[model samples]
Every structure is written in structure tokens, then in C-alpha cells.
Target: MKQAKRKKLKKTHAPTLWIGLFMMGLLVVLAVLAPVICPYDPLEQNLAEFLKAPGAKHLFGTDQLGRDLFTRTLYAARTDLWIMVMAEIAPFIIGISLGMAAGYFGGAIDWLVGMASDTFIAFPFYLLVIVIAFASGAGSHGIFITYLLVGWLIYCKVARGQSAALKNSEWIAAAKILGYSNIRILFCELLPNIIPQAIVLLMTDMVGLLVIIVTLGYLGIGISPPTPDWGTMISEGQTFMTSAWWLSVLPGMFVVYTGVALSFIGDGLADRFR
Candidate 1:
């Protein structure tokens, strides 16, 4: 039966997931080593080499300012990875805690959390992110603030449902009878059960965050000048797209690559649970 199950999983799961995991791992390593391995300062400019096409000295070519696109692209990965981590962490913690509490307790707490989550959800998702970014002022700080303010709803909703379902389980009753503190029961028992599903959701949400981050950058409401952001790069590259397709295409590809990798990981996790 064990061998059969393994075979079943292998047959059912797409190869894209493994490929995505591999790509994601590679990107992480690249992001980590970017500063050390990058060929040039992403911000350094040489008008002499401006708009040069891919060659031995410069791989992804040069942007309008003659900054090496290769270097900028590598560094952009680091910026994006940092943003993704910072933006996701707060939401994960706060959302899970509120969700667990609301689900387990299910009274005023539930009503309050439900209302807040509903309010956030009612707004068009990307529009809310854009509004928050513009209102808070554009940059990493603004994006982080926006994500913390609203990103929790997705995780909270998922965790709430899971917690509600599990709250009355036999083991929960046993834990209560044994005098487990509410805090201990919620954190130790309920949290552990909800995490697997939450993780899948987290991976998917990261992709959305990446898109929002890029979109903000593209719209000039995100990472500021001299910072190598994929969206910013794409925005800057658009004017020269006819003459230098690589300018926009290469950085945009990085966004696509990361998104695809994350999507595969999320899909893989969902499939595993199924």
C-alpha cells in the first residue's frame, strides 16, 4: 500500500512542480550571492556602454543609463526576495493568531475578525494594495505597511475555517479536560493542525504580493530610483523596447520565473493535501 501510494503521487503530480522548486531554490541562492557575484554596481552608469546588447562583458545588456542589466537583474532578485519575506511574515503571524482565536472561541472575537476581514476582502485586492501604497508613500516601507494592514485576511479566513472544524475534535476535548490553558490549546494543538493548509495558501499569496510589488514599481509608486527593481526596470525599459527588447523582456522574465516557481510550489502542496 505504501509503494502504491508513492506511485500514485508520482503519477498524479506534474513535473512542473519539481522544476519550479528547483528554479525557486536556484533563484534564492542567486539572490543571496548577488552582491558578491554581481559584475557591476547595479546603479553604476557608463554612458559609453549605454544600451549595449548582450555580449561578453555584459550579459543581459545595458539599460538606458548604461547600468549593466545583468547586475541590476541579480540585485533586483535580492530586493524582491526581501520584500516578499518582510511583507509575508507579519500577515502570517497576525492572521494565524486572529484566525485561531476567532475559530476556537467563536463569539465576539469571531464577529469582529469576520467583519474586519470582510471589509478588506470587499475592496478589489490589487486596488487596495495600490491605494495603501500611494497613501502610505511609495517604497519598501510603504509596501510593508500595506501588506501588514491587509494581507492577513487570506490566512485568517483559511485558518478560521480549519480551526472551526477542528475545535470540537476528540483530542481537543481531551486537551480541555486535561486543563490545557486556552493559550496552550490554541497554539499547540490548533495551530499545528492549521499550518499545513496555511502554508499552501502562503505560497500562493506570495505570488500575488510579487505581482503587486512589481506593479507598484512599474507605476512609479514602488522602489525608488537607483534601486534595481524588476518592475522599475520594465517600466524604464519600455521606451527602448523597440531598440532593446532585452531591456524590458529580461527583467519581466525574472518576475515570471519567480511567479511560476511559487505557483508550482503552491499547486504541489495543494495536490499533496488532496
Candidate 2:
């Protein structure tokens, strides 16, 4: 019975890592090729064509602004991808570095770093980003910074815990015995080992992050108009849901599909690693 349960659990988690990698790859391709593939300018609007439903010309239909939903979504991919990459890297770099430092030395710095990390972790992660978003005047750049502040703690916590575990390991002791520099051990040895774990965690959280960013846009608290964010698209479509379901539905589908793909890839990678 226990074996069967474990097998079921493995099957469930398999797709997460795989889907995550696929999503990441898709986002990269979109970022790079969206310009050529999407014929219409994402920001360009046509008043005459406004409120058009999904059709042959405009597959995803026109928005309230008569913008090509397909084109806008493709371009919007750029923004979403940028946010994800920036948000993840910013935290990954800072948090991992600080965490390594804190765990390796094990002194006053460790306590201070640990306490600060814990304090941030105590709060709801999304809430912190939202507050920072609003306070910083609420735009892409602002939101990006807010994301970094809110997200770094996770990486830091993980890296710190991982580093602590290796502090007394035989390999680490050998490195120390050989008088390896702190930089060599931290980057060449410690950081490299911990990164796979970080990547897996990042994959797991990417979808949730997408949802939060979308919600912020939907609520008018995220990327401003003219940007055509997915959340904002849904928000704009809400009033006309009965008449223009396509406006919201298409973008929402993109969000869900992309989320699913990334989640699957992430799960697969995690399973393989495990």
C-alpha cells in the first residue's frame, strides 16, 4: 500500500519539472521571435474594428481598443517573460550569495541574515510585492523591483539551509584542508551544487508568480494600460463578459496553458533529479 502511494505521488509530480522547462523555453523563443511572428503592432489600435469577436483576421479577436488580441498577446509575452526572468535572476543572485555568506561563516552575520530572512518570510509573499508595487508608483520597473524584494527570501532561505548542511561535509572539510579560498569553495563547489535545487524551486513557483502578476494587472495595480497585459486584458473584458467573452477567455487560456506547460516541465525535471 505504501509503495503504491509513493508511486502515485511520483506520477503526480513528474510533469512539474518538465513543464516548467518547456515553459521557460517557450518564453525565451517568444521573447526572441515575437516581433517577426506577430504581424500587428501590439500597441496599435483600430477604433473601427473595436469589439470584434474572434475571427479569421484576428484569431483572438479585438479588444475594447480594437487591438489585435493575438498580436498583443504575443507582445505581451515579452513583458511577462521579462518580468519572470528579471524577478527570478534578481533574487537568485542576491539571495544565494547572501545565504552562502551567512551559512559559511556562522557568526553575527549569520544571525542577522537569518533573522532578516525569517522576518520577510513571515509575511505573505504576494502581499509584500503588492505593497511595494503601489508604494513605488506601480509600473513594470516598480513591479520588477517589488518582485525582487519579495522573492529573494525564498532563494536565500534555500541556499542558506543547503549551505549549512554542507558546512561539515567531508568534501568541504577536504577543501578547507587543502586551503582552498572561500571564493573557490562557495562558487565552484557550494553554489554549483545548490543551483539545481534553486532552479527546481523557481520552476515550481513560476506559474504562481504569473498568476499573481496577472492579478495585479487585472486589478489595475500592475502594468498600466497600453501594455496589454494578460491580467489587464481579463480586467478589461470583465465588463463585457456577456457580449465579448473572447476578450478575456483567450488571454486567460494562454495564461493557464503556459502555466500548465511550465509546471509539467518543472515537475519532470524535479523527478529526474530526485
Candidate 3:
């Protein structure tokens, strides 16, 4: 039974990973090739062709400013990918480190970490992020700073819990008895075990972070103008919905596709690790 289940899992894993890779790879390629492949400057505007429908000359149509929608969409993917990568780094490091300390130490450190995590998780997650983003001001810098401040709590909590559960295991005890340094035990011994779960969390968080960024852009508190963000594009297109549906719909589809791709990757990772 166990052998059959493992074989089944192996069979399923490849396709899932491939699907995820295909979608994610497409986004990366679009971003990388934007300079070479985009038909027009994402910010270049020609009032002459304003709000044209999707067709041969302006594939994916033109926005109100007559900027090529397809080009803007492609550039938006680049912007989003960059922002997501930058935003995730600080949190991953701080959260995992602090979580390891809190869990492994299990004294005042654990208590304090618990208190901090509880406070952050207490509020509606999106609400907290919005308040922070709005207060920080409207730009990618603010968004990056806001996420760094609040993002680590989730990782900390996860690592803490996992560490606590493992701190009492035989191997850990053996390592301790062997006089392994705290740093060694935390990084070399325990971190390897905790990282898989954190990685899964990282993928899931990527989706959420992407949504928050787009939401901020929509609300005028995210990436600044002329940068080609999907959220900003969606917000810009709303006024033209009655006549220029493609303006909003095309950008929105990009967001959906990217989100779904990241989600599928996260799901695949979760299943593979399980």
C-alpha cells in the first residue's frame, strides 16, 4: 500500500510541477523580453489611437492614453515580478531567524514572540497591510517597507511552532549533548527541517503579497504612475468600461493568470513535501 501510494505521488508530481513551471516561466520570459518584444513603450501615449479595440495594429488594444495595452501588460508583469522578489526577502530572513530563536529558546523570547504574533494576527490581515501602506505613502518603497515590518510574523510563528515541536526530539538532544553551538543547532540542525514548511509558506505568501501590491496600486498607494502596474491599469480602465472593456479586462486577466500560476506552484510544493 505504501509503495503504491509513493508511486502514485511520483506520477502526479511531474505534471503538477511542469504546469506550474510553464506558467511561472511564461511570466518571467514576458518580463525579461519586454524591452525586445513590446510593440510600444509602456508609457508612450498617442492620443490619435486612444481606446482602440484589440486588432492587428494594437494587439490587446490601447488604453485611454493610447498606450499599447499588450505592452503595458507585459511591462506590468516585469514590475510585479521584481516587486514580489524584493518584498519577500527581508521577511523570510527575519521571520525564520526570530522564529528559530523564539521556539528553540522557549523562555521570555518565546513569550515575546507569541505576543507580537498575536497582536499582528489579531487584526484583519489585509486591513493591517492597507493601513500601513497608506500611512507609509504612495510608492514601491513604501510598499516594500510596509511588508518588511509586518511580513515576518507569519514566518516567525511557523518556525517557532515547528522548532518547539522538534526541540525535544532525540537528534536535537544528542546534538546538544555533543556540545554543538546554539548557532550550529539552529542553522545546521533545526533550520533544515523547518525550511521546507517555510518554503511552502513563501509560495502562498507570494500570491497574497501580489494581491496587496495590486490593491495598493489600484488605490493609488502602490507603484507610482507610468510604471505599468496591473492594479493601476485596472483602476485606469474602470472609467472606460462602458466603451473600452479591453482596457480593464486584459490587464485583469494577466493578474488572474499570474495569481493562479503561483497558487498552483504552491499547491504542488505542498503536495510534494507532504
Candidate 4:
């Protein structure tokens, strides 16, 4: 029965995972090669060509500033994707470590983790992020700081639960019996098990984080001008919705595309883990 289930899983895993990886990989490649493939500089404006509709020359049309929307969108991918990946690194490490420690130690450490996470959880997540980002001042710095403050709570909670459950398992008990130090046991035993779930969550969390980043940019508080963020592009394009709809619509579509790709990866990982 287990062998059959394993085979079934192996069969299903490749399609979803590969589709997602291909989509995401394509975006990353385009973003990386934006300078080489893009016909115009993302920031360079041409008054004569301003608001040109999508043509052979400008695949995504031009914005009001006459900059190539296609170029800016590609470059924006570079910025947004970089932030999406970079922003998570610190939180991932901190959240997993703290969560593991809390679950493994389960005394004052647990209490503190519980208190901190609960306190943060009390506020609405996006609301809290917006408030923090606004207070921190609009830019990448604010976004990073906002996430650093609140992003880890979900990971911490997930890790804590998994760790708490595993702490009493045979392997953990055996580690203790073998005279392994707490640190070694936590990293070697607990981490290996907990990390799978964390990775699954990481894939999903990135989607939400990307939304937040785009939202902040829309609100005039993210990435800043000349950076060509999707949110900003959407916001800017909204003004010309009737005349030049592609300005907003194309970027928005890209956002949806990226989100879908990430969701596929998360779903695939979840199935694999299960």
C-alpha cells in the first residue's frame, strides 16, 4: 500500500512542480536578461514615443513618460523578485530558529515566543504591515523592516507546533539518550523534519509578501520612482485606463502570473511533503 502511494505521489509530483518551476524560471531568466533583450532602457523616457501602444517595437507599450513598459516590467521583475527572495531570508532563519528553540526548550523560551507571536497576531496581519511600513517611511527599507518585525510569526508558529510534536518522538528521545547536546539535536534532528513544512510555507508566504510589496508600491510607499515596480505601474496606468489600458493591465497580469507560479510551487511542495 505504501509503495503504491509513493509511486502515485512520484507520478503526480513532476507535472505540478515542473510547471511551476518553468514559469518561475522563465520570469527569473527574463528579469536577468532584461538589459540584453529589452529594446529600451527601462528608465529612459522619450517624449515623442510617450504612451505608444504595444507594437513590434514596444511589446508592452510605453507609459506616459514614454518609457518602454515592457522593459520597465521586466526590470521591475528584477526588483520585486529580488526583494521577494531577499526579504524572506532573515525571517526564515530567525523564525525557524526561534520556533525550534521554543518548542525544544518549552519553558521561559516558549512562553516568550508565545507572547510575542500572540501579541503580533492580535493585530490584523496586512493592517499591521501597512501601519509599520507607513511609520517606517516609504521605501525598500520600510518594507524590509516591516516584514522583519512581523513576517516570522507564521513560520514560528508552524515550526513550534511541528517541533513540539516531534520532541517526544523516538528519534528525539534516542538523540537525548545518545548524549547529544541540545543544540546538536535541535539542528540535526528537529530541523530536518521541520524544514520541509517551513519550505512549503515559504513558497506560499512569498506570494503574500509579493502582494504586500505591490500594494505598498501602489500606495506610493514602495520601491520609489524610476524603479519600475509592478504596483507603481498599475497605479500609474489606472489614470489612463480608458485610453491606454495596457499600461496598468499588462503589469497587473504579470503580477497574477507570478503569483500563480508561486502557488503552483507551494501546492506541489505540500503534496510532496504529504
**TM per prediction:** 0.94, 0.87, 0.95, 0.96
Q: For each candidate, C-alpha RMSD in Å?
A: 1.8, 3.5, 1.5, 1.5
TM-score (C-alpha, index-matched) for candidate 1: 0.94
Which candidate achieves the best lDDT against the true structure? 4
Best by TM-score: 4
Candidate 3 lDDT tens digits, 135-218? 877788877877887899889989999999999999999999999999999999999999988998998899999999899899
Off by over 4 Å in 1: 1-6, 11-17
lDDT of each: 0.90, 0.81, 0.89, 0.91
Candidate 3: where are CA atoms >4 Å away? none
Model 4: CA > 4 A from native: 1-9
**Residue 158 in model 1: lDDT:** 90
Worst 10 residues of 4 by lDDT: 129-138
Which is superior by lDDT, 1 or 3?
1
Residue pairs that clash (backbone atoms under 3 angstroms), model 4: none
> For model 2, how does the per-residue alpha-carbon lDDT over 116-185 read when each residue is reduced to its tens digit?
8777778787777778778876567766776676677778888888999998899999999999998899
> lDDT tens string, model 4, 6-100?
89879978688778999999999999999999878888889999899999988888999899999999999999999999999999999999999
Give the alpha carbon lDDT tens digit for every residue of 208-252 in model 1: 999988999999999987888999999999999899999999999
- Model 3, backbone clash pairs (residues 3+ apart or across chains), number: 0
